[model samples]
Target: MIIKIAEIEEEVVFSGIICADRFKSDYENVDFFGPVEYSLKIGRSDKRLSVKGHVQCSLNLLCARCLESFRYEIDSDIDLQLLPREMAPTDIDLELERDELDVRYYDQDEIDLTELIEEEVILNIPMRAICKEDCKGLCEKCGGNKNLNECKCESGRDTRMAQLLRSYLEEEGDGHGGSQEKAIKVKKG
Candidate 1:
């Protein structure tokens, strides 16, 4: 939804649902399970705008570890200072001050809230989604889901460390090391 700057004289409260079609193309991989619900209070002072409210939605996403489909919920608070794009400095490597962290740039006399709502949902999604805290993940050998059942795959311990330890023990022969001599003898015999 696009809100025109001219429409807001002082402050306006808007509560509505944004359909999924508005941002379906924005994220190809994301599948929104429902429409985005928003309750925003937009205030205008000169050309500057302040949008404060909350947005929430549910999404169907794949778990990073188990690769299973899971429902991810997003409930984000919106407290943004909207400024005209022309007001932004042209410096490419400029660092933003502490107060400018929540500032967002807008183009023309309208604010495209569709983009803002989509951004809030995307930012809340976890980088690595886990279905549960104790998810066993998939087995390496037979490619089976370990959460369902245990696999009969043999234990595959790396032998390089064992070989290195054996050589180190052989070099320390009979020199204040009884355990090392026993280990060397066990390996050699």
Candidate 2:
């Protein structure tokens, strides 16, 4: 939905649900259960626009580690300032002030609420989706979901440090005929 700047007298309030299918093309991996819901109050002060609202949705996602399907909830607060696209800096390397972090740009006469809603939903998605905090994930050897069932494969220990220590012990033994046990005790002390 596009909000025309000319139509706003002072402020406009909108609340509605956006269908999940609307985002299917861009986010194929994520399955939206409930439609995206929003409640926004967009106020205009001359040419400047301030948007304050809330956006929420339920997303069906696969856990990154175990690959199990899980439902994730997204609840985000929207507080942004919108300015004309012309106000955006032409220099790519230009630094932005702290207050400008929440600023967005709209084209000539309109603001695309649909695009803004999509961006909010996308931003709420977690970088790493985990079903649980202590999820064991998949077993490497058996290729089984460790959260569901424990595998019988031997626990693999990282041996790089052990290998380096062994090499060091061999070098010391060659130089001074020192016992491996004595060298280990000296190194520990």
For candidate 2, the 10 contiguous residues with the lowest summed lDDT are 180-189
Model 1 regions lying over 4 Å from their true place: 25-29, 90-95, 98-100, 154-189
Q: RMSD in Å for candidate 1, one decimal?
A: 15.5
Assess the local accuracy of residue 157 in candidate 2 as a C-alpha lDDT between 0 and 100.
62
Q: Model 2 — TM-score against the truth?
A: 0.76
Displacement of residue 79 (Cα, Å) in model 1 is 1.1
What lDDT tens digits, residue by residue, belong to model 1 across residues 22-112? 6667664567787989988989998888899999877666655567767767677889888888887666545265146688888888988
lDDT of 2 by residue, 1-189 (tens): 988998987899989999989787776468888799999999999888999998988877777668888887777789998988888776655426624568888897799998898898877766556566556677768889988887777345637886577556544533431221121111100
Supply the global lDDT for candidate 1: 0.70
Candidate RMSDs in Å, in order, are: 15.5, 14.7
User: TM-score of the candidate numbered 1?
Assistant: 0.71
